[model samples]
Target: MEQLHNKNTHGVVRFITCGSVDDGKSTLIGRLLYDTKAVLTDQIQALTKTKHARVTASDAAIDLALLTDGLEAEREQGITIDVAYRYFSTVKRKFIVADAPGHEQYTRNMVTGASQADVAILLVDATRLDTSKSNISLLAQTKRHAAIVKMLGLKHIAVAVNKIDLLNFDEEVFKKIKEEILNLANTLKLPTPQVFPVSALLGDNIVNPSKNFNWYQGPTLLAWLEGLDISSEKSGVNLRFPVQYVARQDGSAAEDFRGYLGRVESGEIHQGQQVTILPAGSVATVAEIYISNGLNSFGQNTSVEMAKAGDVIALTFSEDVDVSRGDMIIAQDNSSDLLTKQLIADICWLDHDALSTSRKYILRHTTNTVFTKVKNIIQILDIETLSQAVEADSLGVNMIGRVELALQKPIAADLFDESLATGSFVLIDEATNHTVAAGMIREAL
Candidate 1:
């Protein structure tokens, strides 16, 4: 029974807004911030002074897009180019919101934001979906972003049919768009997705229910977000603790003060538990555990009975075992066959320099960086058709592909579907040390 302090803290939910250009990703986020009363007085004053502000006879409205589109170029062009993150909290939950770029050229920026998000809010302009002919589908970016979200393994999705106010809150128009989105979700085999009709610019059906939409009995966007169960999503993972540092004291107490300091990436660790150290294949018993209290600070070294996922803990071992930074501390019962050299992964190319099989790059996972090379370009994914091209020679910027990699050493890792924290990595350019690509492990080869 670990004396774990207040678990009553409201959990943080990381979510992203993505769609085609002019789909209102930035405005949606700005609405969330303002309606929640998270905006400061000065921020409001700055928005009011901007030329882009929209005012009504009865009330005034800021160019809410300016809230997330902070770049001068973005504001001038009225388009988002980079991923913008905003943090706010309600009584029920805290939120870390990301406004992803909606342009086709900035697909890489959207991928970067969606990779860490727990849920995705896919926005669709209601005006686009009001098709007189029944055959045409939604925009290309709408479908492309949905496929990428599924590949990233973000199971929870919220289809927000935005700008419904443009349609005079027409129920028939909302139903048509909802049906089209649901059809797409079924084709992608996406999990149960929730749909909401919203007007981010007008703040309708966002934080508060809209009187204009009397037919909609669904929860508001904020309410649905608050009701999500994030803990269930984190359960059933294996223990993976990557040692960031070895904590040592310099006094008589130092004799017994050999502790491995790191955050628990997944699963639970308990006192008296037998653990295995990777690469070395050594075994040791967990002697005691101490959880961090604050920055550069620690609580009293108490003998915690158990520590679960997301805890930043320092633990001492009963027996001496060789360990250092980059070493993994996994429970003995959870050990699996580790991959030593070759692996197959899904990669999203992020650099101007195309991936070349002839060049050696740096592969970084967790705390380890190793020399690696692209062995084979198996296939390139076509976002439009959601199919693969078997004859790809190289992966271009913003292209998604499957590739085989040869590493200098092995890494203790899991399939991306099984464990997100340990299964993802980045490729770095050896010369410039720039992040060239992001990868999610499919399996060991």
Candidate 2:
């Protein structure tokens, strides 16, 4: 139940970029990092040195995509192959950009990267917009990309129509592509995503305004990113702080000292507040909220008495509670519902072996892991069409399905839409020790 309720805080926004195979996603990421001065001198030199064999038919003095597409094969083929992470921050906010590869087979990487991101940028090549003859396969792939991003819970999406210079900066093409994507977004029931026409290669509308697109009026990508905030603004929600560990001064040093360690997952947790530990249903009042760097009883220096929403703090309890890892603390006031039972969720399959209907795996939710079996694959959404179909017996790689997981014992988790911390789980194949699927909590926890 740990929640990120504050929308105004200077938070780290993780984003994933998805697009057609030739939409310049890697190039766009490189340009964003370069324009922001996030690239260092040594890394820049490394990029220049690799230019000997990294040339494509469309080559530049510096192959910017080399800044992100790190694989040797990818460099030789002039394509992105793996999901690359590029971290940077600006004057206003911090960012973690997951540059996902665009090929159809790499869809699992996109899902993995998408799992941790707050927003998504879908880049499109304006010249190759929805062509029935040339881009038939690409159009189908783009539809799946949008559907998967929505399923992964990206609150805000930005469509950057890249390579406008190739189209002579055509305004009509921009409008037509924008309208087409808008229609598709509406069909997916996703939040109305904003669109920006840009040339990531030419540095137009990326860091600053573009001189070539005089008719384009949308906010520049940088300005838009700076202005945007996390959409999960559910403040005043029920408190959910799951305990990760217990630290104590045992036997001798300071026998009276005891603390429960965990991050603040949800609503505000103040010192000396009443709380109930889940599963055990033990009630206690917080005696002191101890942080990693706690100060003594001096009212001179600055020390936060209370953590707002996202801050992590350790707490000492009034009562001698036997709380351990995987336990949850609920604020006493809002104890309406607590669950420990069967659950359903949307799953992103990752294993090359199909998810057999009768198979069992170790399900990890937060710090708790339990043996679970695939009860059913209730709704299998056609990735290309973005619509649900009849029940399938097995799920393949990169295929997303709404599954009902039957646990050997009841587990404590929240509906993903209700609380992301409690609502997410991963499935590990017991025999091979490989993570086969990533799932989010669904209705009726």
Computed on alpha carbons, the lDDT of every model, listed in order, comes to: 0.84, 0.77
Where does the lowest 10-residue lDDT sum fall in candidate 1?
1-10
Cα-based lDDT at residue 236, candidate 2: 34
Measured with C-alpha atoms, the lDDT of residue 15 in candidate 1 is 91
Q: How accurate is candidate 1 locally (lDDT)?
A: 0.84
Model 2 C-alpha lDDT per residue in residues 1-445, reported as the tens digit of each score: 2333555647777788898788888888888899899999898887777754443536355667888887878888777778999998889888889988888887878877877778899988877765334223337667778888877666789999898888888887777787888887887888898898898777889888988889988789878887886757433347777787787766875556677777776777777789888777788988777555544222212334665556566778778879988788888886656655678888888889999877789998876788998888898878667778875888998788898878886666677776777778889999999989988877655
Off by over 4 Å in 1: 1-10, 52-60, 248-257, 299-303
Compose the digit string of candidate 1's lDDT tens values, residues 1-445.
Answer: 0111223335788899999999888888999999999999899889988875543424335788888888888888889999999999999989999999999888888988998788899999988764576754889889888878877888779999998987899998888888888988887788868999999888898999999899999999999999876643533457889898998775685555777888888788999999999978899999888888879455645557888877988888999888998889998987778646888998988888899999999998887688999999999878777678997899988788899999988888777777777788889999998899989888887
Question: How does model 1 score by TM-score?
Answer: 0.89
Report the Cα lDDT for residue 198, model 2. Answer: 91
* Candidate 2 weakest lDDT stretch, 10 residues: 294-303
